[model samples]
Target chain A: MNEILKFFVNQDRMLGRNERNLMYTLKYNLKDSRAIADNKLFAKRIFKKNKLPIAKTLGVIRKKEDIESFDWSKLPESFVLKPNKGYAGGGIIVVYGEDKLHSKEGNRVWVKQNGVKIYQSDLEKHIIDILDNKYSLGGTKDKAFFEERLKLLKEFKLLTYKGIPDVRVIVFNKIPVMAMMRLPTVASSGKANITIGAIGVGIDIGSGVTTGGVYFNKPIEIHPDTKSKIVGFRVPYWDQILEISTKAQIASGLGLAGVDIALCRDHGPTILEINARPGLGIQIANNDSLKERLERVRKLKFKSIKHSIKLAKDLFGGEIEEEIEEITGKTVIGRYVNMNVEVRKKNLTVLAKVDTGADSTSIDSSLAREFGLLNSFDEFMEYYKTQKHESKNIESYHLESILDFANYRGIARVNNGNGTSIRPRFEVTIKIGNVKKKTIVNVIGREELKFQCIIGERDLNDFLVDVEKKI
Target chain B: MESFIQTAFVSNPTLFYYLLLIPVISSIIAMGRNVVGVKSYGFQTPMLIVFAFLNGSGGIEGSLFLIFVYLISFFLKTYTKSFNLHYLPRIAVIVSLISVIFLIYFMFFFKLVNISSISPIEMVIYISISEIFITSMFKSTGNKVAFLMFFNTLILSILAYIVVLFIPQWFLLRYPEIDILFIFITIAFSRWKHLRFNEMIRFRSVINDMDKE
Candidate 1:
């Protein structure tokens, strides 16, 4: 623990106590719950404003007068009664229709599929409890809001039990950092929170990329409740979602936050609530960390929303392959040597891969001879032919490489390590998926790895890669 | 270091009380992140008191004793609640009174006592203090709400502490696992979904299928 703290401190990349504490407090205090609570009132208002979409509010009830004098006929057969400040789906009564409702101690209450009805008196008791504010953020009194319940999206039916499906978009500095679609599980306290027991699907931060759905905190392809595979659902208006989340950061006076969005049949894109203190479950959903990604955002300077979104993508988007490349100081993702290894220096197309399986990225020993550091290896090799180093430093390389990498068109660089003891060949550039770049790499014997001028896994995944299947 | 562990696990007979905290902490983190409750102080403290009950009443036997405890405490709290007393002070008085009575009755009638050689007076004082905190919470809030959360903490902690008991490989690995469990629970709990027993109260209104009440 001391070492870990010292490492982060030595890097000087983390926020100080005041900012870190504020960021965390702001997550719980400034947003998430408050914004969700505000939704009780603003939900109807936002729907009136035509800001994307939301469930229409039938009414917001406070004391007895609100329920007694209100028009009962105006209510849809199926609607949701929720605590304006409720957390974790508390004090909520959902009616499938009139058949599912009953008069309990003089007031009508909603029922679930199992024929459980929340009586009006029970609602009153719950409301009184809320009024007592025992279950509020600061134990403050709250009201109850009634709204039309949303139908679960077809694509999400398997992921959800009976509640509406919600997608969480984590925003930092006005950009969407990580995104996951949370489906309600019976385990999640009857709501779609991943912590209690919900299924989370990692979406591509780019194009809302969705991958690796998990349940019960383990990698799982099928929903534990519904027994269906969770995959391949595209969120409409990906950019707009990020835009709304960014706009919410400004609206909520919070910088680091999450925006809960619901897709309605009529409303299209609805902002369910904004969460200030979003959980780290997002890391499991995305299989990454908010701590590290937030660190990147904290270091950046942006003038407007545009710069922020760009930084979000660069920092936390589907750039895992790229991050690994930068960290290992080796071009690992894209560059692979072939019968025709074409090296080009006129224009650098740098895409790297990450390979934890290998000890060191090996290039042609001739490349090391060019950098004049081959003697260092020889000196160490004289004592022992093999040496091991935990060198995870990034060093850039510019290589003049001619071409012929399996008929792919690109010049590349061999990204080198920071230490001077290791010599780097010229830069090798490999284009994986859509991204391309040049990087410095070390040159060594490939008799073991069996590929000439091959871009190590460290560099191959820097961008994205799809192996071209050909005849 | 020795004193802290001694206090947590050894030397202190009610170290089990602190042991109960592990599950409370886990459950609260679970509730806070996944359950999304406005209630913070969480269910752990009350749960600790509940564990003490099972411990004092001799495990399963104490569960039977809880019925009497509930009836008596409920009658008293009902009086205190209706009197419109300010929350904190009313709880303070009720807790003190309940602690005095329970300590006397439990020690004399149930013949239940915490066995520690340190000091009989200290043991008595400890139980008194513990009772004061639990009783005040019950008096301030209704016993039902306190117990609901208390039950939640107890259930979760029982499972968690039992699992933790099998771990630690003799204490060297114990401390780190606590922190790890904190982080792991934080991440895992982010995805929870389930219904609260409170929902059962809410659902009672809709149970009759429009049978003309």
Candidate 2:
């Protein structure tokens, strides 16, 4: 934690709350209000004017008279109805196709993407609600508009629960700083809102491939419902997506903006909305802070949107992969490696099995006791109890620091040959094939088991596993 | 002009004293909003001034009334989960419930406590407190946030009250035109794009880094 603080201090890359406010006050002009707030319709007009690809606007019902005079038959079979000033994903209705039985009543009924039937009257009432500004940011009167319902790309069909998934790209000074793909879930009620339980999968800004996913603010690998892997899912047309987002930022004229894009199976990626004050949830999704990214690009000059897009890709793209390689070096190891494991302040050389199946490394409890880690664990527990009594609860970060001192890191329920039992994890230093690293290893009652230690994939990321080679 | 100022100050010293808090309270709200990243309604300043004035006028009873109103409104908002009524109507119902509670308190408890010093202005202030409470309840997303906002507002009002009460009346009287300086100060505050004091601590690492660089 101190190192992270020192790193941020040394880098001077952390953007504070005041910096954000000052950036908005100094960089974002008052005239840019239309580009930033309650101006999705205005933003759409700007997109149309700039010849940017966007969902076609069938019609806009600004007032009651417009709603009455609007011809529902002229609308597309599948379309989206949304309020221009609607904040987040509120006041959005996605229609899949026109219901044939209700079409006899002259385009009065429609089928929702989630298979719910909606009548024309229900839509009109929703439009009335939109006009009432029920879903608007400030509850000001709003305009309801019909837009082309972009078909979900095949790659995202299995990943998204029911609603359309959209990618949010945070563009700062015409450069794309960060991007996250928001997937709708049943909990979010078909809306890609992180606060409402939509999955926020962080996309590699450079490569446009998903690096990680966070659901309900917790790191997750797969869709909770669909069970499809979210990480490493390469977003199609990455460069084009970045290009369009940059164009939207340039067109919007807001120095800081969030450009939302959705991929249409036929039309490719289309700009959905450009938010002036985009949310900070993308930070958690990417497991990276926005301050460093914003600070990196805030001062740079860009001749064109294309140039900026390329720069963003070059600078931020494939960072995770590079970081892995830098930390691990180009070392390769066999499936089984003879390693000197240090625990309880004692060292023992043991033949450790390298298993990718385990999420973490594990060590035998007897070996852990021999190293005096078990005694340290008891001391740590006493300290933790006193701290908890004093502070009511220890912060996760502080708890981590305490664990670090105690040489105990985590607790996990491990399934062994006998049964599943809870085990305490201890921090151990291991030297395998000349590469020495410190990692947390779960201490289990593995006295009955053959191998005293098992090194998992997490510890093995730095080394390529060669099953046939003997080390 | 001096005589006129003295007469005006003498006529209503409390109002004059509390009026000076307007700019101070406004600056506090502005700084608080910038630090917390929450939007401040236009009425928040006036609400604080009124709260401070009422507390000054009726003392403990006035503060108790405000606290009771806020608690009732917060509880009503939290417990009534399925009340899918419209925003205006929902606020109206909560306000009505608060009014009833106040009425009951005045009718039964007021006689027993015999705190007859409560002025008509204090009553009006108590009523206005409900409006601000309801508005805040509506604006905030959760009960905890609503309570926090209320607490922040309360703390600021109390601070303003302290400033108004403790500051020498003679100093204010002699420097009557100092109020104009407050307006200019407010304008400067509005244009202040610098990092807030809290932000300095929040981004201390960056500041420390800049210092080293």
Best by lDDT: 2
TM-score, predicted candidate 2 vs. hidden true structure: 0.65
> B119 in model 1: Cα distance from truth in Å?
14
What local lDDT does model 1 show for residue B71?
A: 47
TM-scores for every predicted model = 0.49, 0.65
The true-versus-predicted C-alpha distance at residue B121 of model 1, in Å, is 13
What would the per-residue lDDT of candidate 1 be over residues B1-213, giving only the tens digit for each residue? 855765666555445435534553565545542344433234444344344443443333333334345444555556777665544455566656665776687567653444331233432333343333344343233344555544554455444444444444335234534655565665555443332233222222222211321
Model 2 alpha-carbon miss at residue A395, Å: 60
Best by TM-score: 2
Q: Which stretches of candidate 2 lie over 4 Å from their true place?
A: A1-12, A28-37, A72-79, A94-125, A157-161, A185-187, A195-199, A213-229, A281-301, A324-471, B1-7, B36-46, B49-213
Please state every model's RMSD to the true fold in angstroms: 21.5, 13.9
For model 1, what share of native contacts is present? 0.00
Interface RMSD score of each model: 19.1, 5.9
Score candidate 2 by lDDT.
0.71
